[model samples]
Target: MSDRHFSHEVWLSKLRDHLTEERYAARTSRQCIAVARHFLRCLDKQKVDVSTAQPASVEAYLQQTRRMYRRRHGHPTDYKGWQCLHTNGIHMLLRLVQGLWPPAPKAVTPVEILQSEMRGEYAQWMAGQRGLAPGTVSHRCCEAGRLLDWLGERATREELATLTHLDVDGYLKYRAAAVGRRSLKDVTTKIRSFLRWLYMTERTSRDLSSTVIAPMLYAFESIPSALRSGDVEKILAATRQDCTQKGIRDYAILMLISKYGIRSGEIATLRLDDVDWRQEVIRIRHSKTGAISYLPLLPEVGEAVLKYLQDSRPKTSFREIFIRACAPYRPFRCGSSLYRLVRHRLEAANVITTGKRGPHAFRHARAVSMLRATVSVKDIGDLLGHRAADSTLVYLKLATEDLRAVALEIPTGVKA
Candidate 1:
């Protein structure tokens, strides 16, 4: 707070360089610098502390700008454009100051500091002692922190000796009101794990994990979202007919999942060198399990991919085979991007699929197809990069016809 004065020239110069580096147009850069300079000058005139300036000041300035615009141009159709420039300029300066949208940081208390330390220690235990994946550890640690935050002082190591099942019950009930049955199951499991860890570490007197009851959810209660082979055919056919760059790319992507059962994550992270054309095989590096599996580059999938690479794929130096068709072209960010692409393709093709509509729907469809083909469970599991038998068994829920064929009729003597 001591250095309350903002040197307008110094900050404006920095903002100018930043805007130029970000490729903002010359006029836009000037507008942005002008707004930032105006904000700094306002702070000096009002003797506002730079560290503690309120966001309300930004809104006040914007309101003043709006009035000035009306007086100068009388609410022209394009006045909204100027308004956006003002908003962006103010936000840019604020973000540069705090490294966030908010002007001030929340003052951390002793209890908050303790809570953070506890979460970090728990994360270390989960990662080191349990060998959980990074994503799993982060999620469990976050869930534990949520409980600590909800209980406040009561959740401290010194105070947790008095903790009981009542607190766990209340927390579960509170969370159940917000999330669905399926997501609530994950919450309950994560909360239970935290409670068990706390008791084992001697932070809590009682192990209240068992009391954190989840909602009623039967194992494999719902079948996997499997688009029928015919529906998959329809989607691919629709994309093939379009014959655009995007359509070719979509067809190639669809073939990978529908024919080979490739996971979205694997597709996103697949590198250019992973594909061996001479060997007629593609290497899959699994992130979740750290297992690498090589799959045959089937003629159909390979041909589609070749067409995309030769014609439709962006000319980026990125090693990934697929790239975003738009500017700032880059490989797909993650599995979610793949999900959106598949969903859009499905909707565009007017293919109304059951259960999951994302790329995984085709994966499930492929699994069911293999099962029906009398392919060994081992082969199906290998193709899907499944790490456990239970993971592969989930798709059996979708193999209704096969299940019916193998059904053992109920004995007449055992019937009620």
Candidate 2:
């Protein structure tokens, strides 16, 4: 067959060969082939000659194909789904066209050019221009990519320019319904940040950042009284005298939570230098507020931690206070470790576990106990390293009696 009249099977075979030769994963190759086949079938249904297809023809074919697919599938054909079906088909098509007609000087469309340019520019700006934290940059890039993916098989920069507040709202609502509230909130925040970047960089004419703000859920007054002091005491007592490395580490973690109201993340990030034996204070660095605060070391908490550090903690070069107890032991890198430790202890103690009873529960418990003891809200906020007094005020919910005392009193036996 002439190159211009290459059959559907021939083009598909070439596409499959390209995917395999590029070392695409097995699943990816299958998906790419599927998308290519679909696109070719779409061309056939439109009676378009694939061999004579130009860039404009390709664009028109994609639009008609999307409408057809939506009519058949009852939903618009999303670019992500199409891309997944034939991984990087657009990029491959561009390359293939250039290769087949080297001297032709293939026409470059604005949308195609913009997508390519924006991707590289956004990545570079996120890394060097914004100097965002590595994790933050990664998250924002992923979110932006998702938005592009939603634009479907022929997304363009102009379409992005035309996006309205309603579009953003719909996207957020779709995400919330698809995933969960927390994930929706996270992705929305990332999108908002990206929009801000776009506005600052003059990528868009109008600022769309104001259209998307994560709604405030409720304020946390105190840790939910998920488990009572009795239950916590029981869990700790069960660990008494076990003396295993895991047990020692867990006990120490629990003690700190109960006594200091220290966040699990704070405990995981604790360093050797954080403890000041002379001053009896533990400095918590890089807390949620990105500020450091010191808490006086209680004798019980200090002793528990010292015991674990010396006796149970695996010897490692890691500067963090805690480390994994198992083989190939590594420093405790995040709050999840502390949560697992608490969970295991709770299971061992036979306490019925409930909503997120990680090390933070101990923090909540401490805050509630302190409030019950009439500790000032300001002092509680300081101790907890909370930047705002309102954050600490959540403990008032736990202190029902305190609130009741200040409420208006009823007159004795007055008839209505």
Candidate 3:
């Protein structure tokens, strides 16, 4: 494409036409317009006449707009709608600029091009080769995308080849500030995995494996204490009183959480076949590790699940164990439904808590109960289908007194 200056109106019109012709989602089109308008405003402020500006100038304009957006709205805590605005906006601006600039020889590093190709290949590998759950693949792809975005203008193949440990360190530090240490660790790990794949493919010479570190073992200090027994009773009672199918479904979901310690995501993805009455187990498919596992169903949990399934569950083609009780019924899309279910129950029960009342609290409560019952940590890990014993060790902290009781007695008076 040849570089040609277009008026702001002309560019905006083109963007609109492109968006309309592409039949982009309403939300996407709105965001594209927002981004285009912001780009125009930036050009006006910089006194860079669009007609006179070169392709490089257009690139600079995009960077300036990104800085302005960050300054105005601040770095997003979560990559929800607003964050989408800034990122998608920049992408749209790039398209608009490229349209005007036509074809130009853009300098790019071999490493950067390889990384791009590797990312696509890796995503496909994850989905097709690894047979990973969709959510798992999505998460890994998101992490890779974030790292590439952070690379920004420096994402050239040559730059990647010359990347130092300090560059990785800086990336981690940026992530720590942007989100948290845990998130930084997650993204870093994903990047490291991608880099490892590239190395095996002979894309680069450096191993750099030693530089990658797993995220620190942050304690589960945030888990809320179990609600009082009375509050639990009240929540249960409130659930029983409501005659609606939704009420029954919510009640049963909460019961499963309180009794079995199932993760909300697992519960959301539950299927009719997951419940085996004869075996007295509930199969949890596509759990956190993308593996299926089973939990022995307690009588109460089994009864509640049966009640919900038989009388309350909406009739739908969705094979999910749980479905929305509302009209045009749909299966629960995410764990957030379970969270909302628990939150509503908490409010109804008049239970007050300092932090968020999510479905995970019930999981914590069950862990505590098991710990208090003198269940071994290893066994607990097995029951929870934890890949590592350390994953279930958080219950140890919550069960401080129990651990104290089981502590080996040391002879204090005699010195070894």
Candidate 4:
């Protein structure tokens, strides 16, 4: 291939023909041809062989072209300058010579390193010993892997043995700046847990878990970001407009979360067998609490699920109730997809969501409604599959209507 050579005229002709075949506009084809000729001329002036030209050589030519324009105009080149055109044209020209251009490098992630170097040993430990859910294990391992990478820098895992509280502090501070308060809390908890595990297994020499102190939270440091009942209605109405198969699946998921307060992961893990049509009950397996609970299947929710199963849900060997609504039909690969589905529906309905815009908004809304209806904390906890009774306390702060009842009154002429 390197032995092959073409004259400047022949090269431009070939580029012109290729661009023409690609259905480029006549003006675009002319511009590309002009740029290609100028690029070849630049290479000739630099005494670089066109067949052996590297990407750097092409970039160098573009820089030189930019300098010439700047020198002539006595100003820096703008984005719409000739250098940008030459850059695009050179790429188009390089396609004719397959080996002239190199492929972009792939990025290596910390999670990939953890999987490859350690075979996710920590993840397995967390799952097996701590009885954590698979999702939790993945999240913990990812955060731990990132912390190790940040501490190690160019060094390897051998640095884990020498990890100090200072290193933990630096990493947590960096994470806090990048994430919000709630997310930072999760980061602090995961990292501290990771360090404790490392010490227990003799992976690290010191236990730095006690040193990692995140912000303390009262009962309701953050408000429950529940969607208003009107917004929920709008979202449901929007789903009715999308008459596609995907629309049906989304509506079913929305109903399950909004009506039953089921978590996204629970919706993903739902199976056909879990829905007892005769008994009119839907069984939910809560990964967070490791509990199985049954809730009454509402008529609307049941109908939506049935319609989705009959229309949108693909026929696959997977037993999961919900499958991808698109081609290569399979069960949802991640629980986050369910959250994104809710977000898309809300956006379509023109509902302006402010904070924590995910499927959990519906969960919070359900709890708030239950509280407004004078439901007991224990009943709300059971409804939402809360493992601890204390988990229900957060909803108490979200009962604005009840709080309004206990407000102190002021006399009409009490102003001093």
Instruction: Give lDDT: candidate 4, residue 38.
Output: 81
lDDT value, residue 88 of candidate 2: 58
Worst 10 residues of 1 by lDDT: 1-10
Ranking by TM-score: 1, 4, 2, 3
lDDT of 1 by residue, 105-199 (tens): 34388888888878889999999999998999999998998898889878666788789888888888888889999999999999989989989
The list of candidate 2 runs beyond 4 A from truth reads: 1-120, 123-132, 178-186, 199-206, 213-226, 404-416
- lDDT per residue, candidate 3, 1-416, as tens digits? 22323466677777777776655667777877877677666667777765455556556765665676678888723436645665555455555656544454443676556556756787888889779777777788877667777887665565666766777777777777777666666777777876675566555567665587667755675545555445666788888788788888888888877776778888888888888899898887647776777778889878877888888886667788788765336778888767778988898878887655888767777788788888888877776768888688766777767678779888889776
lDDT of 4 by residue, 156-240 (tens): 4566668788888888898888898778888988988888888887877888999998887666676778887788888988997
RMSD, candidate 2, Å: 13.2
- Flag regions of model 1 displaced more than 4 Å: 1-107, 129-131, 152-159, 200-202, 215-219, 243-245, 404-416
Q: Cα miss at 242, model 4 (Å)?
A: 2.6
Identify the leading candidate in terms of TM-score: 1
Model 1 global lDDT (CA atoms, 0 to 1): 0.83
User: What C-alpha root-mean-square deviation, in Å, does candidate 3 show against the real structure?
Assistant: 10.2
Off by over 4 Å in 4: 1-137, 153-163, 197-206, 410-416
Candidates arranged by lDDT, highest first: 1, 4, 2, 3
Reference-based lDDT, each prediction: 0.83, 0.73, 0.71, 0.80
